[model samples]
Target: MSTDAAELTARLIRCPSVTPEEGGALILLSDVLTAGGFECHRVDRNGVPNLFARWGAKGAARTFGFNGHTDVVPPGDLGSWTHPPFSGFVADGMIWGRGATDMKSGVAAFTAAVLDFVAATPPDGAIILTITGDEEGPGRDGTRAILDWMDQNGERMDVCIVGEPTNPEVFGEMIKIGRRGSMSLNFVAHGVQGHVAYPHRARNPLHALVRLLDQLTGAPLDQGSEHFDPSGLQITTIDCGNPASNVIPETARAVVNIRFNDLHSPDSLFHDIRAKADLVQAETGVSIEITSNISGESFLTAPGPFVDMVAEVVAEQTNRRPVLSTSGGTSDARFIKNHCPVVEFGLVGRFMHQVDERVPVEEIHALKRVYGGMLEKFFS
Candidate 1:
């Protein structure tokens, strides 16, 4: 029996596979793929569930892969949803449930397309699927773990398509060619604690921290790059949790998040932030410490055969030329970029992560047709 994308999507949404929870979604997919003659593996790590499946011989000369997550973000304020978040209800010609658009539907579309494609054409190369349950959580052990295992086991894909919900408005309207990098910086300023009444004796750390933040946000990181907007720095938090107005606090902390393009690196940005801290220390005589965490660096898969082919298929299916874009927060695509050239395409995503999240029923089948077309063209 051939799989229908919409029905598979409904089954997936009913799992309530919230981040870091297997919720039985991967098991269902594994069963489906196994019956279709694919070698499937449960790549579980750190209590998180992931699936890697392949059809065709190992190390085939040409391989195509799809990467996605079955996990959905938590459904907040359950009473606020029109339909139960996990009901998988079909109403008004839409599939209403969590993960409906953010991407359980995307996974279903590609899986259905692959099942039909291999049975019909039996491509000359290989088809691989990597689905994870930890994408909406810490994400350290999802796709990254699968890639590590693939390296050890000698599995590789020449090109990959991340089934992230890429279209902002309508289906087939956009494809992500690259993504900006992300980093978080934390600052702590030390001061001498004393009574507020003694102005000359007490040093205020808040004053120094404010000066440091001003310097960091004083100007734009850079002018817009060829394929990206200018890097952005936003102060996310400032803490000086002293309740007593009479006493000055000994430490003040602040945090800033930076979204950057190819023009900068984590080290380069860290160096600049430390320089500002040093200047503040010299002027205020207040000791300051800076620390940072780099999530993922910016990456781009330049328009080429793989990208052109995906775009061509999208345009033909929807009758609208898709725009190559790089606007969005980071995704698993960041990790996949290290393995091979990668791009992101899927259904319209206006409802992702929102209460009553949904995808139009027609769009689900339309997406399957587009994915099926790409598979046919890639193998021919």
Candidate 2:
């Protein structure tokens, strides 16, 4: 019993399931999984589409889970593509389309692997698939919705794997054990507006904001942690919206994004920034207001049995020992980490969310074999 992963990937690519749109991708997967003897459920919440499919009993003693998103970033500049973004065109031994490497291929591979695995040797345990359609968007209603539904419905998974593109350059080269915490801080400094020539009449809010930003970026947050690089603070934007050189603006606004490691939490970082803003305000008399939103906190699935098993399978199949890294941006694994130990592995991501996104035909098939091997090792 074998599944053609490339063919399945092509079919998925043709679905046009961009962020927040089902585009028939979930419907197609439901039909296939149901045919393969799995129970399927549509866990739609707040108008976002999610699918939960399981094989075996509701709560088996040992259950393996796979998480992935079918939604893709919008394809930019259609004319720039050799083939239509949704064409799923295969040429020169590659499947060319949007979501090819970003991860329709990965979903296809695991789906194929699990379907074939059960048909051939039915594992003693259970398998669960949580596929979401809102990863590329605001993500308020995608996998989170499915997990909420799962908790309410008494569904559980022992360990989970997120099928996100973790490899940067080649198949089996990298696996994400964790991701850095992410947050954005928005600052607004208010002062009296006046003519630039009257230095005493107007307090320049821009000056105070610049000083605050300078303080924030003056030092490294920390030396690189054990599994992660040093925390990064990047000032994404600074604006006063003032056009007149002679007039000082009343308010200046800026935003800084931080990718932090386990050394810091959102509270600690916010407190530190608050202290800095307080000092700047005292020195300059400009009222400073700071607000922050946290995307996720840093997490690591420490080296253990499940992690070793996944690494061993990839090494044996691809002859490449994957580096267990936590160097990438956030993913849905951040949400899954709260439920169970979660890690990310999938196709090389060099071309994801780019023009002419694609994946090699052979790589898709190889990924299926790797996923199938993981299933065998897990249940053995």
Candidate 3:
């Protein structure tokens, strides 16, 4: 008997696997997958749960991998939901729950498709599933940990599909060939504190901080790359905590987040910002300090055989030629890109991370068909 994707999605949603919490979701999935002939491993790291399942022998001539997250963001304000966020209610031809679209459904669809595919055809190559629990949180211990373990254990994949919700408005409209990199920088300007009335006695770090921000955001990062939009930098927060009306603060802090294209890297951008801060420091005596965290670097899997294969299956299943896009925020794809050619495809993302998140029952079945078709083609 084949597993129903909709029922599996409903079962997953009811687990309350929010962010870092396993909430029994992985255990449930491991049980189902183990019975389906997959070798399952509990790849837990730093209290974050992850499941890695594989079908077929390791180091086969070819390997196909799928990556997804079981965890969903918190459902905010219980009163704002029409149905309880974790109810997994099946009504109105849709599954109602927090992870319905942002992607318990994606996981279910792919899992079911793979199970049915192996049972029916048993592909020539390997099938690997790397599902993580901390994708919505810090992300340091989720997919990254699984990949690290794979490296140590001599596991490899030729190509991978990330089941991130990729379509914006409708299913089959988009497939992500790549993603822009993301990094955040915290800036602190330090100066001597003094009374406001004696303006000459103490330098106000706020003034230098403003100039530093202006310098960073004054120009565009790029004129858009071939496969990406222009890079963006936004000042997320600025703070000078002095509450007194007549005092000059010793430090002014600001945070800037940059979503960059292939043309720039975290190191390059850091140097660029440092150059601007250097000018501000040279002009004013206030010293500037910058600390940065780079989430992932931009990557692209050029349109080729693997990409063309997935796109053809999507078009055949949905009759819409999916656009190869690199427009969304980062995902586990960022980590997988280093190991293999990766693309992201799943349900429409219009409801992801929003209140009353849901996915139509029909779309779930359609996605399973698309994934199943891909499996047939890839193995054939």
The models' CA-based lDDT, in order, is 0.93, 0.93, 0.93
Residue 362, candidate 3: alpha-carbon lDDT: 94
Candidate 3 lDDT (Cα, whole model)?
A: 0.93
Clashing pairs in 3: none
- Would you estimate the TM-scores of all the predictions? 0.98, 0.99, 0.98
Cα lDDT tens digits for candidate 3, 99-128 = 999889999999999999899888898999
Question: Model 3, poorest ten-residue lDDT window?
Answer: 212-221
lDDT computed for candidate 2: 0.93
Q: Largest TM-score belongs to which candidate?
A: 2
TM-score attained by model 1: 0.98
Q: Who is ahead in TM-score, 1 or 2?
A: 2
Cα deviation of 159 in candidate 1 (Å)?
Answer: 0.3
- Expressed as tens digits, the lDDT of each residue in 210-316 for candidate 1 is 99999889999999789898999999999989999899888999999999999999999998889888989998878899889888899999999999999999999
